[model samples]
Target: MTMPTSLCPYRMQVHHIKQETPDVWTLSLFCHDAWPYEAGQHALVSIRNSADTLRAYTISSTPGVSPFITLTVRRINGGAGSQWLTREVKRGDYLWLSAPQGDFTCAAHPAGRYLLLAAGCGVTPIMSMRRWLAKYSPMTDVEVIYCTRSPQDVIFADEWRAFPVTLFAEEGAAQGFIPGRITREHLACIPHLKDRTVMACGPAPWMEFVEEQVKSLGVTRFWKEKFFTPSAAPATSGLKISTLQPVREFYAPVGATLLEAMESNKVAVNAACRAGVCGCCKTKVASGDYTVSSTATLTEQEIADGYVLACSCHPKSDLVLA
Candidate 1:
């Protein structure tokens, strides 16, 4: 296995896809040349429909293999990316891609003992890390603590279960399976787990809980990858709200936030985070248009409902929203 020396973010075609679990599937991609990325970094997947809408997916390949990438998509109810990857994307299908980008990687620390914790399908990114570590740093101590609803829900079950893994299943019977969440009490079962460099990826609350618990034990080296829709802006502090009169147009400057654009032009709207993370800044897109930096997991129903995250939205054309 060879580590990628450069960030190769090239468009790739889906060469093969396999259903590994009921809810999870693996996608193998091939490019004209090898695409390279640090383990845990994600690439933006641009899925062009006939109407030309786009979506993004995280890269799940190990950096050790520069040209090939593999991803495990866990089907989520009504999730656009998850559904598309599982039901629509087939071998020989094509998708455009942005260069590999993201800070969630293991390149910063190579020699430390890694405590990788993943819950649900959040295992995708960490799996990349594990794949690389297994090949490049086999001597490094690595322990993966995975929590899933059941054995059936465990993404990459065979691979991880075959490694130095601690399987924590919330339900169903599996020998040595720890029932319940990855709480402080459960972590105690793993001797010396607190002393390792923890890398956690999961739902926001799960990551937060792990960070809090790990910090409580005086372990400070903790890395977390939190997934959340962009949040709404706070009501107080540098925020002004105004409603648009019926049948009026508004203009906002370039780089102005949807909230800022609305507020600057006296268009009343809600906001949060200003960055794409929390889902609080959502609003209906009534008879107008705006540009969103990233979709940030806006539901298909929400897109139909005209809901846009105001904090990360920028006006491209004059639009009306309430």
Candidate 2:
């Protein structure tokens, strides 16, 4: 997706890289600017080799720390972004990043008790929160439920020990870790479960399980920010879209996202969290209609002014870009 010039990128050098687990690695990028961001937010990353290919990776380092930002990546067998980050990149390489952007942060409200749940590399962002909490709200009550394949593959194995963590595994055994997925029994074990704000991140199914299990246990303040890039086949009756600046035109499927359609047609538009959580893809709708799944980062006033987040909206009529 095209990135906005105002939010173009901060060029940072790769300071260090560490293999966190068998298939997971952490990249520590040297921060040249005083890049400010909350603990749980993620940045849009892109290397010069593949400038147009950007992916979101959460910042695992705390903002309180300077000169560095860490991103923990889990290698996915067929995943292009993760694989490149974990294997292809070398030390001292430069990476372009959009300013940290996301709403999945607890920095503003740090005094409350929290229940952090993570699986696999989802622990990346969770670690940021834990670090921030430890540094700032040192007395705040916190509990964690970390899951992985086995003891051998637990990311940040020793770091999580500082907090009250319940480990769940789908395979081999460990003394303190359980041997199955998170269940109702586990939620019931955490003291004051109903009062703690629950935050979970992981695979869709695992997150779904966490949502259902936690709500069933009477928890209402649940927070999770998932970066989902929705996909679909372009419709046979293709709908056309036009961009303003240079008057570019393209045809997008009826139900397909307007942003995805533009990307397919090589139209330049910036998108951070393809899920509409970040408003980087905001575009003025010069003269057409579209449907939206969530208002997300747009204000009611902005909607009245014809601004739409291209990622979440589908073309209802032929669109004219402003």
Candidate 3:
């Protein structure tokens, strides 16, 4: 499907905001001209801050629901964006948003059975896909294996239990639930994993671990969706950053984010959502090597093209940004 224009016309108003966890809040938005987003797609939501700075978030709600989109935000200590969202944002507040955008989605495969693996808030996008399938492709059998630290950390606990689901809690469960992380043994317990197409979304380590475990099972069509980028270090000196030139090079700090480092060097990169979820600030790497943060938004082709999100990427070594 074609994406919406750069300047989104839809205006969203916060209908309700509720605390789901000690650090996470569910913000529901009411929008005009219902936004068009496919399953697993994310919208770039921007909220006005005290100094008029805009903070961006990803739309967690499925687009099938008219006029409403939900966003789940996890509070990060010492984060200006998190602090503003939790402390200053109020119900009925209006916010600006870009058209929904994201490439992490379920490809049309005629596979009869499927596996959905998710961790923490990573469940948001996968939930969208699940809802879509439930809406349009009811016969597509699905099995959800969700992992979290404990029952309290489960984001969509009640809703998931109502479906064909397996819950894995690390801290321990009261029975009918698996304890600890998703290990190879847990995967082995699932029937027909080899015949099913698996879609995984979570932290990088989680994705890597599951991908590795499932590889030996002869599952060739495993797809991964994550919000975290791979780790990267600062860029070296004597480099330039811009979109005009097809060839570019720059320096980035180990701890300093790619956006922060690039902006510090006066590079013009668009980053509506500083968080890794939004794909803005994504650029082609062209050549050289680098790493991503907790959230990764690179496609297989983009990865081949050396593309990277300047917002979440840090330079692991001196590299070029095209």
Candidate 1, residues 33-95, lDDT tens digits: the string is 655578887665543432122334556778755346876677766555667878999899875
- Candidate 1 at 286: error in angstroms? 18
Evaluated at residue 73, the lDDT of candidate 3 is 76
Give me the candidate number with maximum TM-score: 2
Which digits, one per residue and each the tens of the lDDT, describe model 3 over residues 194-305? 9888888887668889999988877887887655432222356533343436344455555455676676555766666555665668766655556677346778887667
TM values, all candidates: 0.68, 0.74, 0.72
Ranking by lDDT: 2, 3, 1
lDDT digits (tens) for residues 1-322 of candidate 2: 3332334468777999999899889899886787889999888776334555567788888888534798888787655578788888899977778788777778654547899998877887788888888888888898988888898888888787777788888899689889988888878888999999888877655787888899999998888755342222333357878777897777886556888787656677776667676676888888877888766888999999988888888888998988
Report how far residue 133 has shifted in candidate 3, in Å.
Answer: 1.7
* Candidate 1 TM-score, C-alpha based: 0.68
Candidates 1 and 2, the one with greater TM-score: 2
Cα lDDT computed for each candidate against the true fold? 0.67, 0.78, 0.68
Q: Which predicted model would earn the best lDDT?
A: 2
Candidate 1, residue 78: Cα displacement in angstroms equals 2.5
